[model samples]
Target: MELMNGVFRPYADSFVIFFIDDILVYSRTEGDHVRHLRIVLQRFREEKLYIKFSKCEFWLNSVAFLGHVVSNEGIRVDPAKIVAVRGWMRPISPTKILSSMGLVGYYRRFVQSLSTIAAPLTRLTRQGVDFRESDGMIAFIEARLSLVKQIRSEAGFVCPRRAS
Candidate 1:
């Protein structure tokens, strides 16, 4: 926590630090944000805590922090998490397939018709077939990749309607 405090002290006026690891720098004005960032970076240097510059995002209307993606709009699944879903691959061994299935199944709710889409692959597992990419696998891969962009957007979850 000491490290976080040192990294955050300079930007105290403009931003609120959350959960030590997650930093939410707020700005009442665009100019404030710029200034706040500079101060924050300096504090980081003083603290000797280096941020992964490549992963550091700035001036984003929304950003994925921790497991949840945050934006000016709202919170949702992290884009990095979605990329994992999109890049999912069929497993070669029975154990491997089951493990992969478990991981993918966790996010099944986010993917539409997940069972229907994965039916063929699931059947292969039940029948104890060796891992081999088939037409069904190829189709599934293509279908899931196609849905990546849409799923990351508004289609993620069903929002409740306002009561009249």
Candidate 2:
């Protein structure tokens, strides 16, 4: 892709860019790592490229690049996504409520007792009720968000034995 080539061609031998902007600089030795970083930084300056320092990580053996968290530990969902899940809010429309529930349900495996956890909210959906930020709704939202924060993994599928 032009975007990738434009941003990363200069660092090809020593590093690989993941997800377009997530750069993973690799080196065979510590000295090489330092040199590679310097070279890359220099190229960035030359290209007039700017990076968010807060999002930049260095000297990491493993890291979360893109959606999957990469590290020596292996790949998993990014913690920030987990945080986003944990802070999910109840949608205000029937369609949006269903959509939100569906999205979260897709990752149900990451949330323990998902069925039970979502029982209250699900009931409202079944009854064709519009979403509201009522106390119970708020509680359900908080619970789902907390569950998502606690677990960061792809959800398993739960097939409906009988179609509606």
Candidate 3:
């Protein structure tokens, strides 16, 4: 959090976006990109932060961030993630259902009314509720499947522009 506020805050909604340990630096042109990259690297150097080069993405038009593909155009669920979601089988237990729900829940930004659709499954996971694969199970399947399609076709990660 200190790194986020102290090092990246100035560049936060503009040239760089850092979520946890993943840092994505973007610019409209190669020259601007180089400058932005230099600035970030210099800061890290100043702070004595170590970076394993193997894990870094230097120059790319788009890259996967937290299971979502992000670019200047917008953000969308990574195709790889969507494939995993599509292959999910009907969960037979509360734990299974919760796991499935948790995965899809991460990409809820891609789907409208996802919380409402997921309410059924959420209920089944609550304490004292018998984990029954009845109404909630149906809703879960439908919600899971629908999220795959929506993310694949229509979803875009919209970065909010903070008022400067």
Model 1 RMSD in Å is: 7.2
Relative to the unseen true structure, what is the C-alpha lDDT of residue 95 in candidate 2, on a scale of 0 to 100? 62
For 41-148, candidate 2 gives per-residue lDDT tens digits of 887798788989998888887665655555543445556766666566655655655676776665565567877776766666655554564755775776676567
Which pairs of residues have clashing backbones in candidate 3? 75-157
lDDT of 1: 0.63
Ranking by TM-score: 3, 1, 2
Name the lDDT of candidate 3.
0.79
Give the worst 10-residue stretch by lDDT in candidate 2.
Answer: 155-164
Sequence-dependent TM-score of model 2: 0.45
- lDDT string for model 1 (1-164, tens) is 66676557655634655566767775656997888788777776876878787866788876656555555544566677777766776556656556655655665556677677667656656664544657656755765664576467645543222222
Q: Candidate 2: misplaced stretches above 4 Å? A: 1-60, 63-66, 133-136, 152-164
| Candidate 1 pairs with clashing backbones | 62-71
Residue 17, model 2, lDDT: 56
**RMSD each, Å:** 7.2, 9.6, 3.1
Each prediction's number of clashing residue pairs: 1, 2, 1
Candidate 3 lDDT over residue span 92-152, tens digit each: 6779878987887888777777887778778877767654647766777887777777777
Q: What is candidate 2's local distance difference test score? A: 0.63
**What Cα-based lDDT does every candidate model obtain?**
0.63, 0.63, 0.79
Question: How well does each candidate superpose onto the true structure, as a TM-score?
Answer: 0.47, 0.45, 0.79
